[model samples]
Target: MGISVTNISKSYKNAKALQDISFEVKPNELFGIIGPDGAGKTTLFRILTTLLFPDQGTATVAGFDVVKDYKKIRNSVGYMPGKFSLYHDLTVEENLNFFATIFGTTIEENYNLIKDIYIQIEPFKDRRAGKLSGGMKQKLALSCALIHKPKVLFLDEPTTGVDPVSRKEFWEMLKRLQQKGITILVSTPYMDEAALCDRVALIQDGKILQIDTPEAIVKHYPTSLYNVRSTNMYQLITSLKTYEHHHSVYPFGEFVHYTDTRSDFNPEDLKVYLESKTLSDIQIERTEATIEDSFMELST
Candidate 1:
């Protein structure tokens, strides 16, 4: 195993940030902590990186205890926090060099590790970290994190607020890094990214709702689900909410995802009923469960 989390828990004043969290990451595995805001993903990353002490339990990275072997853990792991934490006033080159020096190494010593990522941002090497575009800043931060060639990497919501193209590029970079045998623990609010990881742990309100391969998570959704949409989306949603046979109905972009209490569900019957209610352009279709759908089921 590359990382082991054993009953780890943390809190801030009266609010619980994590509750007896436990999981293991095998070597070179891309492990994701999937959840929304205030889900304690940051707290868990901070504790594992030895930045904050956990209220209870223990965790280890690269075979070093986060508490007693703080220095060793720091030397063997790279962390990119959720927020851009580099020296904003410093040029891109300066920031990367500084991080390398702090780890008792030079960029040249481990340049190969970040070469692929650095090339993209090298054109803006002299630009201030804050002045670079979001995508460029993201690349620089990732380069700095990998400069020391740590055994494990922790990324806390690394793609938040970035454009879709940049987000896609950033994940591709991670895939390359994974190919080089680095274990990654990344957290994200975007459910689509969950499918990219080798395995994921779904978290909400400071609890581990489920942990498994994304495919398995989706398959575990107990009830059959359908996607429905109508010209009067608002009325359609309201009608579904009060439908006696429905188990759950939630809006999902252009369509609403719905499940029911009946085992013998008939879409034709549903269409006739909606037509009688004066809803027009109603569309309904059976759909495969998604990671997001499974999350909703577990979190609810």
Candidate 2:
């Protein structure tokens, strides 16, 4: 009814791309694969989509085996790779029609399936896909992928290149699609986006660090963290790293996040030390754990 992956491994020449990776995606759930570049997210997506085979273990999508039922799996699932794989030369409408025709279904047949997305790009129906803006291009690509009304949707870093507005709009669309009972497997490098998923797998260097709901993952963070800010952001980072009592210090937005090396941590002590160091406007406050914070703890 959903996706199942177990101990899947892939290799290229002497390098290991993915090792012992496994996870399950529930039907109609928005499952996210969170990782940075070179973390094997693409390889795992390809193997599950039946575009590539694994060196070990097995996977299934929509209840079909990746190896034996590849053809059926391909027909059952829709894939939008990280790159814009659609024809740049074709007009938006042409691309949609082309994909629909190939799937043995007309646009009219699946009009309801992609209607919400297709209408947004319909105004640019005559425009070439390459000429459209990044956001517009994204909509067209998604429309074509859904033209077949696939049971499972695989999107690889779909919002990577779009603007902030487009990124927000795209996620809204995904939420709408989920209400219709389409299982979505999305991969993103942005840690903030991990919170949008029903469940996420934090991946790094071809391995999964953790898999759980964003809230659960954050709850698993083991350390008490704090936000430390001063007039000189750059200087504060270096000073905190060199500070003997600091456990970890990294720039996060306008403030620098820091953890204490000692069990008896005190915010007042850190503020006093920074003041002695001639740092003005210093503010130290306890902060709640975030998905990124948890990921940093696990990935390290």
Candidate 3:
């Protein structure tokens, strides 16, 4: 088994963090938990990693119970928290050695497992982890997480603060790791990254909105989506929202993604209405649904 969560619930005093959430990751699969900040991604990760206990329900990681077999689960999973948690005063190499030693192993014993990720940071081995750049710190953290060659990896928002180039590189590294038969559970707030996973769970407000392959989720979008744009973007949004038949309108990059409540909706009808509002240079056309589109629909 890879990972299993059944009716897991957690709360923090007056607030509910995760409410009866359930999901599973198949062995060797690249699973993604996609959500916005405060969607309880970190809380769920902590529970699965055995750092925190769920208020209700149960979870297992790598064939070990999170509560009963916590020790076994800890040994079988590599966890990289969202924030950099390594010793700031320690040099990169020293930090790696410390983690390896904690797991009753040596860096040389698992050198091949982290070779691809470590080499990039090898030149900075002598530098303090806190002094390394954001990207370098990310590599160092991942190297330490994999120091013992755990069967499963849990990366919580691993690319949140990194530059775009580094984010891309990190995902590529994950792809290679998946090919090595290590089941990966990654959480991210970036909707664009959802497509890269084999499957994704879209969560919001402490609830699961949907779960499926990104492509399948897009294919099942409930309404016909259109991309609408004009010279006055602000006025266009205001006017679109005020329209009588409009179902939903959200700003997406350069265009507004719109859905109509009527089944017989026509672009020309919308174009005419927009022109009535003195919105000039209006462009309306059918557009393919994206993961972001599906998320917006589900979350609403």
Whose TM-score is greatest here? Answer: 3
Error of 1 at 4 (Å): 0.6
lDDT of 2 by residue, 218-297 (tens): 98788899988999998889888888898788889989989987888988988888878888999888899898888888
> Which residue pairs in candidate 1 collide?
none
Return the lDDT, model 2, position 218.
91
User: Which candidate number maximizes lDDT?
Assistant: 3
Off by over 4 Å in 3: none
- CA-lDDT, candidates in order: 0.93, 0.92, 0.95
lDDT of 3 by residue, 113-227 (tens): 9999999999989999999999999999999999999999999999998999999999999999999889999999999999999999999988999989999999999999999
Ranking by lDDT: 3, 1, 2
